[model samples]
Target chain A: MRGITIGQYYQADSPLHLLDPRVKLLCTLAYIIILFFADNPYAYGLATIFAFAMVMISTVPVRMILRGMRAVLFLALITVLFNLFLTPGDVLVEFWIFTITRQGAQTAAMMALRLFLLVLASSVMTLTTTPNKLTDALERGMRPLKIFRVPVHEIAMMMSIALRFIPILSEETEKIMNAQMARGAAFDEGNVLKRAKSLIPLLVPLFVSSFRRAGDLALAMEARCYHGGKGRTRLHPLRYATRDVIAYLVFAAFLAGMIVVIRLF
Target chain B: MKLILDHVTHIYDPHTPHARTALRDVSLQIGEGSFIGLIGHTGSGKSTLIQHLNGLLKPTEGSVYADGKDIADAEYNRRALRGRVGLVFQYPEHQLFEADVFKDVCFGPKNLGLTQKETELRAYEALQQVGLEPEVYDQSPFDLSGGQKRRVAIAGVLAMRPEVLILDEPTAGLDPGGSREILSLIASLQKERGMTVILVSHSMEDVAAYADRIIVMNGGGVTMDGTPAEVFAQADALKEIGLSVPAATEVCRRLYAAGIPVRPDVTTAEEACEEICGCFLR
Candidate 1:
């Protein structure tokens, strides 16, 4: 069950990990936006190359990135299949009432490639940046929203805390499920309704424990004099370095190249 | 039924990046109707070993034989084995989710396919065994005190009428009085019912007072196995592995170190007191 690696950070001492998280987050956003404009074959090729470069430089195992892709593989396949059957264009193949058109197949491939690259690019951000650093970068990047009375720090902290609890709650759920299983609770043997009913024993304890943990955490935060990020000081303030500037410039060049490629093609 | 683990090994998340060897090439025999105390520091594979007793976890290598039948065999009935070997996990009460204590206790026997009457009878008998009063039967288990809820949870397992009972830190997070009550209840159940009881605990004092045989686990293997007296005699060796003997045994050791005529093997407070008194009288 621990194989769920979405939003999980992989620890490594690569250039990606050393880059400022703010820069990485912005670059990820830019990369994703660039994917939408990557309509032609050349643009798609450039996007794929950029993603591969990012993954290679991050030094995270290709296996880990592909594991994250598993979650979206079905969606990508569905999108491709739908476009192959649904779109109108010059027909390439005909089978039983369905026509595979040239435009439809191209559109399907492009959509699938877009989705795959989008997932891979976003995963690269989460894989390299720790949750704490991600939150810090988010808060720093959203500081402009303070003019609209947005609680940027609080929002970022809440997001980070939620992300932090995902694995913990999952582990707790596994423990509870195992405990119930030891008592002859058959989780897998029943019909759909029965299987869900079997989960009552698992879910009740999990909810109770989660509430208790949240209360305890709140009390702990209060004890530590936490007051909603008001006048709060950070031990490691987000700082932009020379490498971060170079990374931003490189991504900007990539974005300009993507736009030029799309226009030329 | 006698339980034999022959060179059992277990690995968690095998072949993955997070793969961990929780137990390795560990073999032991648990005779029927024996009260065995499993003692170990945290992460010493004590939990993993007990889970193997009933086939809750299959050994990665070797085999587990219950009553001379290999449980790891493909045709083995694991559900029946689970019914025979009941496990009460740490904070077993957390697993309780029934509307009332009585219904919660009835879960196991019901799962065992017992008739309504037989299930109720087993639940009542098990509740009595755990010393929970009749009045709390109709109340929600969540409303009970920590100790009471834990007893109810144990009653749930006991209702299965297991031949071999395994408890993992059953007294953990309880007050001293509550811990004593739970341990004594387990002792009585083992004695009166002749049930094979395997208690996994961190408290050396509790095991010293109650268990006839003690097994020490360290670094995914059985490091020491003997009677409590024999095991506690090698206090220095146990200490080297980050485990300690009972307080009474520690006191006896100190007195023996001071050149007093007291046996360092004394494990209980009563035994220590008697030995010190006898030394003074002599």
Candidate 2:
């Protein structure tokens, strides 16, 4: 559980870290969409540089960034493999009704690079922004949906609570696992069926307690007179600043560079 | 069973940015049938140290020896070791998950592969030992009161019939009366059944009142280890580590300074009372 590097906000003082999370959220989406349009070798190279520069600008350790890549490695590998053998063209190697084509190799490499770059660009955002700020941005970004009676505030509140509970629930899980292990509950020793059976001892309590915690949390919130989003004020409302404007300008410059490189080169 | 931590060192999330040295090169020996109170401030490696005793955690650098065998070794039967050296985690009630209280207690011995009759017998005895009534056995563990749930959780470990029972803050989050009840129950288990107990707690008086030996931990190492009187004697040093002498021991100190000819190292209220009585009688 500790090895998981995705969605963990790394604390660092950098321009990217200081940028408004809504801007970061929107820019990340734009970058992914832009990546899909980057076709030629030089365009891919520029996109790779953009992803690398984002990681550097965020001041998040490259090692931690690479650790996040490991999580999507299987997905990347599958994409590469499918493109490698399934995309038919001029055959480069053939065996047992399977043919590796010249275009297939190129497509496979591009697909791998694109998948990795996609994850890298997103993780840079996640690693820079704290979960609270991310959810705050999410709530603000979805503010328009309140017109449709979408329960925007409730959804955001739930997201924030869920984000808060991940680490807590994981810690609880470890304690529960240790507790059961001390009872001679062999979690690792059993066959697939038996191991799954063993988890009942661990999971049932966790589920029960999580619900209990959620109930308690609701009571605590209500005790403070939380009556949904109506007439509610944020502790720290989101606002655009000079740095956010500079970030938007930087993003626009990057987009122009991306479009120019892709269109001209 | 004799338990020995041979220069154990535990590092959590080693070689990572979040790495922490939870336990340093600390060594200790716990003999059979001894009630040893392991006291320390929060995050002072108290929890990390007890986890090593039963092979629940492998030391990053050292070995945990139980009955002259290295538990971390590939040859050892860790399953059996865990059964004999049961560790009840802090807030153990969070681990209870069976359909009923009786079945939850039986989970431990059942894991040990005891016969159905034996498991049920141990569960019944364990529930009785924790002072729970027969009527609650059929009810879900979740339906019980906080103190009752805690009892059921403790009974879960006790049902395993471990020779060495290690409870991490057994009385935490309980009312004072509930705390006293649980502590007395533990004391009785040590006295009546001769079970070796290593109680991990933050309460100074709890240890002084019950433990034969007190082990003080600070910054992932054993800062002090001695009898209750010997450890309490270093009250100033204990306070430096964010711990304090028990309330009674502090009162005893004040009494000594106030020109009373009472023992300076008095730990428990009962002990201080005896000393004051003796001084007055003299």
Candidate 3:
């Protein structure tokens, strides 16, 4: 149950996944800025089309995008409802005490669209790039923080290892749960108190196993000469390619178009 | 304590996209006080089948009855059920978490909400049963050797005072001496407590030497159920499932093949020696 997909990464051979992570990350920031500045239906529509085009280029299955959408549907609904009812504007409809205003509806729709695009674009990046490569890029980008003693390399390496082990630990948990259950530890039959009590079997074992794994992994890392990521040379160095330059150019065009659409219309 | 599973089927993550059938209409009965050896290759549903015996899993469309009581019944307190049916998991040492050995072994009984004094007594008795020193009670479980950690984990379950003690690969990854020690401990425990012990193992020699009855599982179904002598006789079938006959069984078979009139029921080195001598005398 713990091996939940926290980030959306659609595995595709599309142009989106092929783009450098730094470029994609910067583009995502720019996209969010453009989305926030989008005030009218036309500007929001342009941003939506741009996001849709990116999704198409990434070649991620539409169903996966919808699945991702379903996971955060509740949060999206809350955001939309908060904007619609809380924002004071020209009232278009009224029910009981809650009033839906014209401008509020427009604001709600634009906000929802912005969030959806933001998540999708980020997912596209994650889906295409391995976590190791992504972290490498992040560490390289954050190298300027070395002057401030930020330990960017260490932080990135930690994140990479954590991502790598999430699935492994999840599988271990399932095995342990199965093992305990086989001995008559039914996890499902309980009141709230009983349920919490039931968790003792799972939690105790899980913690023990994780700690044991942590010890083993630490020993393994030490044995392999992993010494705090200091002076480590990479086999695949990060470099900005032609594709990355073109990706940035496209992002700039999208940003400019979004501004023009929002300001002119 | 006749544990009967009636046409039991189990699917993990049922109705999800990752739905998988771990067991398929597998029916078997483990007779009370019988040391039943459950043998199978990996993912053969041996693990899944045992879970049903203690009510860890509810079959998708069947029932499991322990001592003629439906284990899946809503009225059955599962925690209480676990107290009766002890399960020692594979690499059980990895389950140790309490800072001290005493508290670690007492986890199950404490979970049962036993009184402080009673819990202490059971924990001590269980530790002694596993051949651990009372002085080691205050020692960190993490500080112990791999075998000791396993013993402490087993003692934890033993503190529950279970009627049926199920072990999943109890001797897994242990050295030869450690394996022998654990097997002997289990044998003595069964004899002393008359506990219905279900040992899941991939080692045919261990099962042959110890188990009175052996249940062979393959692809989520009970392929064979018989006495060790009865099952080992079908050496071809056992080998087909990537399992081998007991060493002595193999020796006797070879002796028989070499035109020696040795008795075929022998499953240990001593038994094989005695039977071969008897054949020569005859």
Task: Output the better candidate (2/3) by DockQ.
Answer: 2
Location of the lowest summed lDDT over 10 successive residues in candidate 1 chain A: A1-10
Maximum-DockQ candidate: 2
Inter-residue clash pairs, candidate 3? A9-A127
Give TM-scores for every candidate, taking all chains together and pairing residue i with residue i: 0.96, 0.94, 0.86
Among all candidates shown, the one with the greatest TM-score: 1
Q: Which regions of candidate 1 fall more than 4 Å away from where they truly are?
A: A94-96
In candidate 2, stretches whose alpha carbon ends up further than 4 angstroms from where it belongs are A86-96, A100-103, A260-265
Which tens-of-lDDT digit does each residue in A1-265 have in candidate 2? 5554435899989989988899999999999999899887788998888788888788888887888888899999999999999998999999998899999999999989999999898889999999999999999999999889899999999888888888888888888888888888888875899889989998997998899899999999989999998989988899999999988898899899999999996
Residue-level lDDT tens digits of model 1 in A1-265: 6765647899999999999999998889988887887889899999999999999999999988998898899999899999999999899999999999999999999999999999999998999999889889999999999999999988998998898898999888887877777778888887899989888888888988898889999999999889997788989988889999999999989999999999998
Model 1: what TM-score for its first chain?
Answer: 0.94
Supply DockQ values for each candidate: 0.64, 0.80, 0.35
- Cα lDDT for residue B177, candidate 3: 98
Scored against the true structure, residue B126 in model 1 reaches a CA lDDT of 98
Clashing pairs in 2: none
Residue-level error in angstroms, candidate 1, position B85:
0.9
Off by over 4 Å in 3: A7-26, A53-102, A127-130, A140-152, A175-208, A227-253, B279-282
